[model samples]
Target: MSVWDDLVGQGPVVEQLSSAAEGTSGLAHAWLFTGPPGSGRVTAARSFAAALQCEETPRGCGHCASCHQVLQGTHADVAVVRPQGLSFGVGEARELVLSSASRPTGGRWQIVLFEEAERATERAANALLKAIEEPAPQTIWLLCTPSPEDLLVTIRSRCRQVMLRTPPTAAISEFLVQRDGVDRETAEVVARASQGHISRARSLATDAEEWRRRGAVVEIPRRLTGVASAVVAAEKLYQAVKAEAKARTTELDEAETSELRHALGENAKGRMPRGTVGALKDLEKRQKSRATRSERDAFDRRLLDLASYYRDVLRLQLGAGNDLFNVDLEPELRTAARNGRPEDTVRRLNAIMQCRERVAANVHPQIAFESLTLALRTG
Candidate 1:
């Protein structure tokens, strides 16, 4: 297998990056990779970085020492920066810029990969822009985000753009079965349900808990029969998202706290050192920000799941030929389509989208989900 093997359904992107890794003239010092969520932008960027360091003839033979080191994140010349909170601040951007000024130690290039460049603050973007504008001869920058428009115009203009498409459902299904050992039926179900999100498909295919959560989300329409039930369902959804976020972050949060205390010598005396209180406060603030973002992300995923279910209902009502995303819930979907007017389904979808916008605008999840469920109920 080559480094490109894991980049599912991105043949054109693989070809372009491979040629560049082979010393093509079109290669630039900075590159911006844009794609939808779970479209593997980060994976593609990492693969390209590994290929640049590969010592093998085809440039990305995954068996080579350099490739292994790069993939494992132990390469001296390669660095990856991923934001832990809601945004990447100027301090972190400056640190990365300072690091990028160094020349390559072992590989042909010194590479810096930034995941989610869209989350960079204005000052952070300016800091990155300076680095990109005056990069070292051997330095290369790879930034990943959902779209070029999410970045500042100045920063994006200085970088070569690489666009990635969402992989087809069939491609995702095949990848899940072949790579993850997921059975074909489950693979197909997950592929359609995930709407081309590769990571989500893998989770739904491999994890029963994920499937149950999704089932709960999609079944909301059936449960929202009265005001009391809608409120109850809304509260349950909010709690579910909070619980998911806590489960995901609890271990990492504790580890980070322990590391900070050890670094500050708190473990030696069971008390914080002088001036360490401020540092601890900063850490807690960042963790809280990260927790909030994680909960919102979980809630968004639930909203998307709910949207896809209604979309299936709409398609069934219209007699559309496209495959339903909620194929496993066909009986429930058929009942929904039979009972609800097509106009009502459209209203329900609009309400769901509006709820997403509201949540993004900092509205409380309970209020947003309550309104959404009530709209779904009335529809």
Candidate 2:
């Protein structure tokens, strides 16, 4: 299939990118792809990069060497910069700028795809801005972010903007069934629960553990019966989240340590080099920072899931007649709506959102969760 096939419910974006790949009127030296989470901004950018490098008659013929190479991230002329930590630093951006200044080795346009451009530090943005302002004749840059306002005005000004919309639930369901071989029932459940987040839908559809965790999250509202129960629930949630984050980080941490040790020429019998100790310490520090960010992101997602359950409850209470994201939990949602006042649901939603803000502001997750649980109990 074509690289564009994976981009669900973005037909207009596909058409624009495809036409540009074919040397149509909308072609530009730089492009900014903006969309909400899971809108496939990065996927669209990669597909466009592949199409640009494709040598086939229609362009982006999936079987062509250029197309395959770009899609597989093996193309010499293509570079993808993804920040593993919370933010992209000036050092990394400068290196990318230098790399993008070089001519393409494959006799086509050299493409640089930067994901999460919103995370670029001020210095990093400045570095990127310089490159975009005076790009190499054979170079192209594609930056992906949640929105245009998240990027520097200067950077946004120099690039052609491409906006992507959330994929419909039906489209997500179909893609899961066709591409991932998921059962239709499970696919639909995950798609609706994801609320247009393709990645979350895939995870929920394929991972039993994720489904179980979400089940627990949706039950939180019903479980907050008193202050003691709320505290216990908050503790449980925090511990579970931390455990999951640790499980995800452990293997990556070990691999990174091994790689760093090897790079420092630390073998089984060799003594440590003079500066290797400091280098290893720095690497560990960075790894810790990345792990913290990962844990925060995981916790934030759990908060969002919690909020969605209450949102469904709120919708039911207000007779909004909107489709519920957590359809499987509708009975519980209706029970809560009937038992609690509409104002209570709104307060709980506000509490969850405030917890998210507190966590983002570096408050202890345990404290934030505990506060949120109590708010739910008393709201």
Q: Can you list the residue pairs that collide in candidate 2?
A: none
lDDT per residue, candidate 2, 20-108, as tens digits? 99987667999999998999999999999999999887888889999999999999999998888889999989999999999999748
lDDT of every predicted structure (CA atoms): 0.92, 0.92
Best by TM-score: 2
TM-score for all models, in order of appearance: 0.97, 0.97
**Cα RMSD to native, each candidate?**
1.4, 1.3
Worst 10 residues of 2 by lDDT: 267-276
User: Per-residue lDDT for 333 in model 1?
Assistant: 91
If candidate 2 were superposed on the true structure by all CA atoms, what would the RMSD be? 1.3
